[model samples]
Target: MRLDGKVALITGASEGIGAACAAELAACGARLSLTARSEEGLRKAGPGALITPGDLTSEDTRRAVVERTLERFGAIDILINNAGIGSYLPSWSAPLEEARRLMELNYFALLGMTQLVAPHMRARRSGVIVNVSSIGGKVTLPWSTLYSATKYAVNGLTEGMRVELWGDGVRTMLVCPGYVQTGFQKNTRFGHAPDGVVKARRFAITAAQCATAIRRGLERDARTVVTPRSGWILVALSRVFPSLVEARMAKINGTA
Candidate 1:
C-alpha cells in the first residue's frame, strides 16, 4: 500500500539512511516522528519534522518515541527500525560493554519498538514494520565481527517475527544492503579498526539510492529488499552456498 496518509516512526533519522527514508515517506504524505541522539542534526535535517532526541537504547526512550508518535499522529502505521551503531572490532578486541550497548540499540530497540507498535497495528488490523539490517547482517566482514553479529541477530529476529506477525496484518520487510556511502564507518566506535576497513568501504551504495529502494518496497509491501543489484546475487548465493559465501568473504577480509 502507499504511505499517503500513514504515520511512520524512524529511528536514527538525524542523518544518513534514516534521514533519507524519513524524507521519502514524508514526501509521500506520511507524518514523521524522526529520532536521533543529535538534536541539532534532527532539527537541521527535519526542520518541520517531529523530533525525538535521545539514545533509543533506553527502554524509556523507546516507549516515549512510540507514545509521542501516537500522540501526534493518532496511530502508528509504519515502524522503521533503522537506528544502528557499530564499533568496528573483532570479537576479542571489541569492548564487551560497547558491543552490548550496540546490541541494545541495533537489536533490543528494534524489537522494543515493534512490540510497542504491534498491538495497535494488530487491533487496527494493518501495519508495516521495516527492519533496516545490512549486507553485513547476512555475512561477516573482517574487523566488523561484532557489528555483523548484531545484524545477524536482527536478521534472525525479523524473519521469525515476520512469520508470526503476518497473520496479524503486520507485514515485515527486512532490508539488507551493501555498504552505503554514509558515515556509518566514520561514526563507528572502531574497536580495533585503526587502519580502517578496506573491504566494506569499497562496495558502497548511496543513502538516496537506498531510500528509493526502501520506498518502493514499502509501497508494494515487499518481503525483503536488497540494494546495489549485486546484493541480491550475494544473498541468493549465501542461502544456497553459505560456505562459498563465507569463503568469498574470508578472502576479502584477508586483504583488509
Candidate 2:
C-alpha cells in the first residue's frame, strides 16, 4: 500500500522494531498512532504521533487505543501489531502464569487489536495488517520455546487473516525477523538466553533494517517478509530436514 498520507497505527511503539517502524512509516509520509506502556518512550519514538500509552493486554486499553486512533485519524490505513514480549525459560518448566501473561500480550492482544480495527478496514475495503513475528515462528528456537509458540500462533493468525480478508481488499503481512539488535533480551518477561544465543547477536540486524524491510514489503504487498532475507535459509532447512534442524537447535539450547 502507498504509505503517503496514510494513517498507520503501530503497537509496542516504545522501542526496538516497533519504534523503528514508527519512524520509518512516518518518513514514508504516513500519519502515526503510536502506543506502548511507556509514555516517555513513545514520545521519543514519534514526536508528532498520536500517542496512547498503556498495557495493550488490557481490554480497556485496547479499546481506548483503537477509539482514540480512529477519533484522531478518521481511519486506520494500516495496523502494525508489534507489541510482544519473550520468554527464555524452558517451556516444560516455565511458570504457567508467566506463559499465560506472555500469550496475553503476544497473541491475544494482537488479535484484540485486529478485531477492533478490522471492522473499520472491512467497511472501507482498504488496509494493511502487519504482524511482527519471529524467525523462530517458522523454525522453533529451543532456547526460547515459549516465545516461539506465541510467534507460531501469530504466523497462523496472519496467514488466515490474509485469506479471510482478501476479498475485502485488506492485506496481511507476516514479518519474521531473525535476531534483531534490540533490547529484547533485556526486556524479556523472564529468564536469559543461553550464552551461545547471546553471542549470536553479533550477526543480528538492526531494528531500523528490519523496519525498512517491513516498509518495502508493504510497498510490494508481500504476504510474508523475512528480514535479513537469509533467515529463509534456516526456515527452508527446518522444513526439509526437521530432525537435523531440531538437533542443531537442541545444541544451541544446551540440551544436546
Candidate 3:
C-alpha cells in the first residue's frame, strides 16, 4: 500500500536493478535494509540504508541479514528477493552442479528469505513481497535454459504465494523484466552469451526503468509486472504463437 515510513529489506542491493529499487523506495519515504556481497556497493545505496554484506547462498548469511534488519527496524514491511544469478549455458551441455548452484541463489535463496520474512509479515497483517524474475520466466530463452527455468520457478512461486496469502494483507508481486542494461551478463555464474545475445543488448532497457515498474507494481499491489512495457507484447505473442516464438528464439540464439 503506502510506502511512507515502511521498512523494506532488499537482497542483491549492491547494483543494477537492486540499487535502483533501493533509491526509488528511499525516495518514496521507505527505509531500506540492503544486502549484497559488496560492502562498497551497498554503501552507495544510501547513507541511511542499512547494509548487510554477505553471500546470499548461505543460510547463515540470510539469517544474519534478517536478524539484523529486525533488530534495527523491528519490522519488515517489504521483502524484495532480488538476489539472483544468471546462466547462459546450453542445457544439453551445462553441468548439473552449475545448474544446482544457479538454483541455490536464484530460486532457493529467494524461497529461504521469503520463508523467514513471511511469518513476520503475516503477524503484522500488512506487507509486500516482490520477487524479481525475468521476461525469460514468461518465455523460455534458448542458450539460457537453466536461467529461464529458475525464473519460471520464481513466477510459479510468486503466483502460488499470492493465492495462498490472499486476504492475509501480505501482497506478493512478480517482476518480469526484459533485458536491462546491467552487469548481469558480465557477471553471469556460468557461460557467456553468444554474439547474437550480446548484440540484442542494444535494445535493452535501463535498470532504473525496471525499478520504477517494480515500485509502481508494489504501490498498486499488482499480481505481475512486466517491465519495458513492450515486453508484454512479446509475452502475449509467445502464448498465442508458441511455435513461431520458439523458432525465432532458436534462430536468435543460434540453436537452429
Find the candidate with the highest TM-score and give its number.
Answer: 2
lDDT of 1 by residue, 70-121 (tens): 8888898889999998766667766788888888888998999888999999
Q: Tell me how far the alpha carbon of residue 82 in candidate 1 is from the true structure, in angstroms, after superposition.
A: 0.4
User: Which pairs clash in model 3?
Assistant: none
Least well predicted 10-residue stretch by lDDT in candidate 1: 191-200
Question: How do the residues 61-148 of candidate 3 rate in per-residue lDDT, one tens digit apiece?
Answer: 9999999999999999999999988898889888899999999999999999999999999998989899999999999998789999
TM-score of 3: 0.98
How are the candidates ranked when ordered by lDDT, highest leading?
2, 3, 1
Clashing pairs in 1: none
Q: Give the TM-score of each candidate.
A: 0.92, 0.99, 0.98
**Looking at model 2, which ten-residue stretch has the lowest summed lDDT?**
246-255
Clashing pairs in 2: none
**Can you write out model 2's per-residue Cα lDDT over 1-256, one digit (the tens) per residue?**
7889999999999999999999999998999999999999999999989999999999999999999999998999999999999899989999999999999999999999999999999999999999999998999898889999999999999999899988998889999999999999999868999998999999999999999999999999899999899999998999899999999888888889
